[model samples]
Target: MKLYTHPDCEKHEMPGHPERPDRLRAVMQRLSESGMLDDINVELAEEISDETLAMVHPPDYIEAIKAAEPEEGLINVDPDTYMNNGSTRAAKLAAGACLQAVQDVLCGEEKRVFCATRPPGHHAELASAMGFCLFNNIAMAADYALRDERINRVAIVDFDVHHCNGTVDIFKERPEVMVCSSFQDNYYPNRYLDYTNEHMINLPMAPGSKGGEWRKRVEREWLGKLEDYKPDLLLISAGFDAHKDDPLAQIEFDESDYEWITQQLLNIAEKHCAARLISTMEGGYDLNALADCAEQHVRALI
Candidate 1:
């Protein structure tokens, strides 16, 4: 498995925010402590260019994000989102990591990749930044992957506690891209929770839902559709926020659940996509749970 991250990602944080730098630090520290990084191919993520980012975001919106970056302190983008001096570059690097991972996977340089970058992107819309996301990293990478003639179909599986409203906003009209998201019911960024098309699959779990119920729903709702779609590439918005220990939501997922989900996605990738899969970091609040869940997810990918 290939792992992509950058120090800049840890630089984007606020003092009292739940989505702070310690989240990334804890995950990375756990991987290092467990010697997992030693076995994986680790690469420093680079910044994505504005032109490429424009595939999913408009030029004006991109410019606005850059312009909103504060010189020293945090500036509020939304009620739950903030940006500091390092945020712009960190967000770009995070998005760039996904782009690089997609390119490498499609080019056959790697079969599976996990991007451990931050400023989670599943909630950022086409022209707005919210839910602690500046750019829709997975969406941008999917758009970038579709640029290649060989990749006609793409599937994004999101298991974040919150729905990927931004991803749905960007790809809802495009039938070639199928988005399967399992998130908590009545969660944050509550757009598209009930919206579904031929390609967009939304699985909203109840507040106290556990891994068993989630797995059952996945088998019933996602697996068949994924097999039928036969995507050329598979991308995952890997989020650990649904874990029971997480403070952000009420879902009762654990490390085992993350591993099981990863294994299922890997099976789909191997069968339909030639194992071409890339997962980008989304949300996971509690440090210990995030670290444990991320390690399990990567172990399954490996």
Candidate 2:
């Protein structure tokens, strides 16, 4: 497995915020402590080009975001999202890491990849940012893969505690890409509840639900959908916030849940896509919980 990340992500964080840089720090520290970091191939993230970002975000919106970056204090992009001096670059690099992961896996450079990036992108929309996100990294990566003539289909599975409203919004009308997201029903950015699309699988887990509920739902819903889709590559919007120890959400999943889901995904990927899989970071607030869950997930990946 190949790991893509950057320390610059820590430069763009909000002070005392749940989505602070320490989240990635904890993840890396734990991976190192567990001896997983040294065993894997670690690469520095590259900044995505404007053309690549424009594939998901509008040109004007991109320009506006670049202009919105503050030199000194923090700037609020939404009710819960903020930007510091390094936010724009961090967001771009996060998305870039996903894009590079896709290309690397598809070209056989690596069969499996884990992107430990920040400012989780699942909530960022085509023209706006929200839920502590800027650019939709997984969405853009999926878009980039679909743009390649050699790749016909891709599957994106999001196990974040919150719904990946941005991803759903981007590909709701597109049938070539299959998007399956399992999130807490009563959580943030509650739009698209009424959406009904053949290619989109939205599983809303009730708050306080445990791993058994999640596992059952994935086997019943996601597995069937993935079997039918038969994607050329698998992408994951991995969020450890569902762990029982998380402070931002009510879901009660633990590290074991992360390992279980990863194993299931790996099985599917190996069967259909030559084991090509890329898992990207999304949400997870509790430092200890995030580190532990990330370690288990990476252990499963390797």
| lDDT tens readout by residue for model 1, 1-302 | 89999998989989989999998899899999988999899999999999999988999999999999999978999999999999999999999999999889988899999999998999999998999999999998999999999999999999999999999999999999999999999978879889999999999999999999999999999999999999999999999999999998999988899999999999999999998999999999999999999999999988
- Per-residue lDDT of 1-302 in model 2, one digit per residue for the tens? 89999989888878888999999999999998888877899999999999889988999999999999999899999999999999999999999999999989878899999999897899998898999999999999999998888778889999988888899889898888898988888678887755658898988888889999889989998898898888988999998898999998899998999999999999999999889999999999999999999999999999
Q: List the residue pairs that clash in candidate 1.
A: none
Residue 200 in candidate 2 has what lDDT?
Answer: 89
- Model 1: how far is 50 from its true place, Å? 0.7
lDDT of 2: 0.91
Candidate 1 TM-score, C-alpha based: 0.99
Error of 2 at 157 (Å): 0.5
Q: For model 2, how many clashes?
A: 0
- After superposition, candidate 1 runs with Cα above 4 Å error: none
lDDT of 1 at 7: 91
C-alpha lDDT of all candidate models, in order? 0.94, 0.91
